[model samples]
Target: MPPHAPRRRARTRRSIARLRSASIDAFAIWRRRLLFLVGGICVGLAAVFMAKLADAAQAAFRQILAISPLLALVVTPAGFGVAALLARTVFPNSQGSGIPQVIAARHTHDPALRHALISLRVAFGKIVVMALGLASGAAAGREGPTVQVGAAIMAAFGRLTPQRLPGLILAGGAAGVAAAFNTPLAGIVFGIEELGRTYEARTTGLIVAAIVAAGLTSLWLVGNYTYFGTTDAGLALGGSWLLVLVLGFAGGLAGGLFSRIVILFGRGLPGRAGAWIGRRPVAFAMLCGLGVALCGLASDGASYGTGYEEARAILHGDAAARLDFAPLKFAATVLSSISGIPGGLFAPSLAVGAGLGAALRDLFAEVPIGALVLIGMVSYLTGVLQAPITSFVIVTEMTQDHAMMIPLMIAALVADAASKLVCRGGLYHVLAEQILARADAPAEPVRRTA
Candidate 1:
């Protein structure tokens, strides 16, 4: 009724509209947050599922060994062949450790191409084939494959909204690492050091949220436990630290040689040999499986599967096979990597590092066996990944060994330098480049069958 009534009414209308708009914006923001949380939980469940299956598969293989160790000669080869065939035909992108595929997926700008690399289908195949490789006695790990699957799952969530999908991919991978190892800090470090190579402020919340969710999920399912049992041994600055230098150099050299060999095969062998292998990939995989079977025989089955049990035994100073376990495990991992089957190097690499450390017990009698094993693990892992921060962080987290942090860092630096001397690039990045190149290449025309 008053002259100012219309103006007041208009102001109230504007206020209500603003409130509605704010509510909508808030809902959208929380929606994406919820999606990320749920996705991370899913990633953790997937990691646990894959891990259980891997353990079961390894157990099954051990049973076969009990029945007759010679059975691996037939079983491993056939398993390798089947895995390779499935990867090549049914799950084209689900090959190798899957980390390289995640890396490649992150770099590509094409949404469709990225989707293809990290699709759910590819994740499914990775789980199945990776298990098959382990069940057949291939020396491999499940961690790297978990990374790919996690990334794919997170990317799927990202698709539901117009959020930063690439960042989601990176976060998924970090979550995978966290859930798989139950090491949240290591996951963030790996995201920065290996996955992203630099920090993104906007993605920080996403990474933390995903990691917390996934880490909590994993803890809930499996309960708290260190990847390797806790070691109270400390490394002093004087004589004890000398072992760090020795193991650093040795582990780095060995690790670099491994990366070089795997890369060489990835690039294809020279001349006719390369062509022959290319033409008969399944057969080559069989040969590689046979090589792994021999390694297992030599190591008294210690070199088979992920080598986790053997590594743990040596690290804790318990009884384990000691017949050049490190070298044979190394050889088996290299073969599994290049055999066109789905598997990971994380567990196997740690197993090799543990073996290497235990073998040098005579050189550093004063150093606790645990200290030596820790150094060797950090050194070799950094050497292979060429990620000093990630290598040391993950190892430190796995063992909860703050006493050896300084020693581990120094060893990581040494190993990185030594690794670069033999290997020009980090393993995952190099393989990622190869993957991108292959993806960009024009697809071969399908041959018509009459």
Candidate 2:
């Protein structure tokens, strides 16, 4: 062969190598994007399904109540028992609101914990059990479970690209919040404030993209509907300042007490009583359900399900929920949560806040009821989650009440501060710690994978 011919062949080989490298790079980019898109779509579809299921559950419960309130006494306890049995027997690690499980998975170093916490099996169990709980007059929300479901779906996708697990989990959780509430901004804030707990420059784009994709999908399916509908009510900045202060303090105290009770129960009911309950979780769940049923009876069924309707009515000033709604709903929520059933506190907490506002409205007749309800929601939710920005933004987006932004922000911040004074830690964080502790136990059985 000629020397010139050899050099030409070398050049051709180099060119082919470069072309091959370029093609690989392009394919990698496309694959990553596709993964993200698929994850977002999955989360969005799950959110829509969760929303519809919640609505149907509430409707069914309402119909049952209309037919016979007595039926709830039997149905609620039986449902809770059945759900508890399923959780223990079929879907271990799928109990309670799913936010804590997500938090535990994200914070833990153990791969098994992540697997146990966020899996397709757990996701399926969460959806089915939460729907059953709501249908049986349990005071629960689908939003928290959606967060876990979203995380599970994304994590399952992440198994395909092992390097992207953390970012994908974060994005999935944020996307779930976005789709659940139809509040993209709140989703972004929740990712930073609650899930990530710090802003990461690398993951910001991925998180935003996921949230937008999921949110857009939800908007397409459900339309751009405000969660609590529109309210023309506006607060007078001068006079409403005191109203904000009252709500902030009151809501903070109430929410803090709630967290304290839940934490106490979670830490195990204090001595033999706790040990007894631990041994008989199914029976305990039934008792808890009875408490919820009694509360529902007290509220005339107003405190059942997610309490979404009452909250919406209060926000729109179309109905005045009974003053007892706050306490009754609060009790029902606490009982349901401690019962080991799959459900969320987001909607019920908002309803509790609305009930508080309704009760307080009688005292502050000068302020618009809608405005007070909005403020109370921000305060109480902030208190529970200790995420002021997320709480205020969620309430604002849900109500489409930009006019009360300043008041809402102020209430949320104050509530967060007061809640810290009482509870010392946010609800989800405390619960996550419990999950981590359990996962670290030597005898804790590794969840079986499908």
Candidate 3:
């Protein structure tokens, strides 16, 4: 061949190599973006489904209650018992607030454990059992289950990419919070405070993108409404600050007691009681359901479901809730939680806080009921979660009230401190430890049925 021909051939080879490189680069970029887009879409769709399910469950419960209070009484125990049985038989590793499972998936080293904790089956079970709990008049929320659904969706999508499991879990969880509450900032804060526990530079963009996408999806469907609706009320900053202090301590004590009870029950009942409960979990769940039913009857149905309507009503200056709402809702929530069903405490906790604020309304006649409701929400949530920033931001975002930021922050801080005094660790973290312990144990063949 001629020398010129050889040089031409070399140039052609070089050009083809460059073209191939560019094509690969473009493909990689598209794949990465596609993964994110799909993940976000899944998270958003899951959030919307969770929201609808929650609403439907509550509506069903209300219909039953209206038809006959006695029917509700019969339904609650049967519903809880059947749900507990289904959770044991059909959906292993799908019980309690789903946040713990996500946390376990994020932290565990074993791949099998992570998969067991957060998977498509578990996500489906979480939604089904949570709805069942709500339909039965068991106090529960969809927000927690949404987190698991989001995490499972994102994690499953992440399998298509080179993303790490922890980042995928974190991003999905944050997206769940954002979409569920329609509070994107709070979702990011939740990622930092509860999910990640420390900001990671690598996952920041992913988390933000997922949150924005999921939040927008929720807004598109729900019309940009706040979780608790808007409030124009603000405090005068003088003696009103005293109201914040009082509310902080009161809400803290109540929230701390709640945390302590839940943690103790989660760890296991003491001695013979624990053994008995372990053996007859369904029966125990039925008894707990009875307690919830009684609480609901006592509160005239205020203690049933997620407590969202009652809390929202109080925030809007409606006096429909009774004075004993706080205690009744608290009882219902604790009982429902200990029954080992798939549900969340977010809504019920906020409701308990709102009821506490309403109860204190007699003392703070001059303060706006809306403001007090917001304070109690932040304070109690902080107490339960022990994440002051997340609690405050969630309350602020849900209320759409920037004016109460300072008071809300103060209440959260105070409540966090008080909660620490009662409970050694946050609820989710403590429960996560249990999952970790189970992961560390030797693997056993998981029975498909109870």
| lDDT top scorer | 1
TM-score of structure candidate 2: 0.94
Evaluate model 3: give its TM-score. Answer: 0.93
Candidate 1 has its poorest 10 consecutive residues by lDDT at 441-450
Candidate 1 stretches greater than 4 Å from native: 1-14, 320-323, 441-450
Residue 140's lDDT within candidate 3 is 89
In model 3, the runs with Cα more than 4 Å from the true position are 1-26, 162-165, 441-450
- Find the 10 residues in a row with the least total lDDT in model 3: 441-450
lDDT of 2 at 189: 91
Candidate 2: residue 166 Cα off by (Å): 0.8
Every candidate's lDDT: 0.88, 0.87, 0.86
**Candidate 1 lDDT:** 0.88
In model 3, state the lDDT of residue 288. 91
By TM-score, the best candidate is: 1
Candidate 2 versus truth, CA RMSD in Å, comes to 4.0
> Model 2, residue 311: what's the lDDT?
95
Residue-wise C-alpha lDDT for candidate 1, range 1-450, written one tens digit per residue: 999999999999999999999999999888878887999999999989998999999999999999999999999999999999999999988989998888888887767778888999999999999999999999999999999999999998998997655788989999999999999999999888877776578768977999999999999999999998788878777877778888998888888989999889988899999999999999999999999999989878888998888888888888743849889999999999999999988889988988888888887888888888889888898788888898999988998989989999999889888988899888988888788777783322211101
Better of 1 and 2 by TM-score: 1
